[model samples]
Target: MHGVVQHSLIILAVLTSLGVIFGLVLAYANKKMAIEVNPLIHIVEDVLPKGQCGACGFAGCMAYAEAVVTNPDVPPNLCTPGKDPVAKLVGDLTGKAAAAVEPRIAQVKCAGTHTKAVKANEYHGVQDCVAANLLFGGPKSCKFGCLGLGTCVKACPFGAMTMSEDGLPIIDPDKCTGCAKCETVCPKKVIAMMPIGAHVRVNCNSHDKGAVAKKACSVSCIGCTLCVKECQYGAIKMDNNLAVVDAKVCMEKCDNPTCLAKCPTKAIRQAVLGIVPGNEETVA
Candidate 1:
């Protein structure tokens, strides 16, 4: 019993001595190796939205903040969620001019909802959009339309997108961070990033000629170039039966609603301005 007691006391003494030695080592290391954090890091982080959406092409909000604080070339307006206010704050913190950034939102280019598009064949496997797209351009007759698999909705970390009744995704612009995650996930390339407050967008993604597009979907662009002819500002152009609008040019020169009325497919939607009378629900 005495021997066991002596061993226990020795073990306790050894443990106490080791603890003291470790404590001193930790204190010395802390004093010698402590890093001096930059004050600008905190300032930059304060102005950030804290959403960490990665819209600024960085890993997260903290990383973007650090880059903005340390790098002179990094623009202050990289945070899409913070918008102009955060830009101004960043500019103040960094002592740099805030670059003017045009706000953009995601829009679904394809209007080929389940009702409008005929199914090419039944898919029997996974419900993932990317997976479905690999199987002969998905189940829809319109090869370049949304697969209605909710891939974009799933990719969105902000919960900004929801599947509509027609099986197409609808984005809540108010909630969207403009992170471009949806634009990346779409297999059909139907989702596009466009300037916020733009008047109109071509909803159809079909590149087939008029009759061919018409057979596939009811509201496909027919490459008629009617919009090109109608626009006085030369904003609209026809390429592969798709109408592309230069938003800056369209905003400056094309204020009239003639093109919306002239489109046979009614695929172009004037989202900002009210639709003209007698063409309220037109497809183009």
Candidate 2:
């Protein structure tokens, strides 16, 4: 019995010694391998929008903050969520000049909601927009139109986007960080990033000819070039039967939206300003 007791005590002592040795080794390794966090990281983080939207090509706001302070190549204006305010804060923190960043927001190029656009085929399986798009350019007859499966709405980390009852995604400009997540997720590439306050936008994405577009979606731009003729500012241009509005020129000279009224399909829409006609006071 005494021998067994001695053996047990010996085993306990050996285990205790091993535990102490491993503890010291761990402490030494931790001290040697400890990563030194940059002081600017916290400063940059405080200035961030805290949206963690990943619009800056980083995982989140914290990750972006680390990159900005640690990596010289990472631009201070990379955070789209924070926009100008965040950029200015980051620049002040890092002692670098904040680069000029144009204010932008997501715009759905296609106005072909379920009610506005006729479906080409009925989808039976997955409800994902990417999945639906894989089967012959989506269920819509217009190849370039939104799939309306809410892929973009799902992709947005912020609750900035919601799928309307019409099955088209609508963006709340107030909430949007201009992260371009929706733009990236859209398989049809129908989402565009445009200036936030710009008055005019081309609501159609179809590159098809006039007759073809007319047959596909009632609201699709038929490339009639009516907008080109109506614009006194040279803001409207015809490209592949689609009227593209140059926001900069339109803001400067095209105060009137004769283009909006003249568009047979109503493809051109005034941005956040909404459906106010030309020669009327714009609603705030």
lDDT of 2 by residue, 7-90 (tens): 999999999999999999999999999998888798788878777667888988889888888887888898887778879888
Model 1 lDDT, full chain set: 0.81
| Candidate 1 residue lDDT tens string, 1-284 | 99999999999999999999999999999999999878888878977877666789999888988898889899999887787888999998889899776778788887787777788899877989999989998898888878989999998878888887778888787787677878987888988888887777888888888888888888778888988898888888887779998887777666675788788878876753222211225523
Which has the greatest TM-score? 2
Cα lDDT, model 1, residue 132: 95
TM-scores, one per candidate: 0.82, 0.85
RMSD of each: 4.2, 4.1
- In model 2, pairs of residues that clash are none
By summed lDDT, the worst window of 10 consecutive residues in model 1 runs over 271-280
Give lDDT for model 2. Answer: 0.82
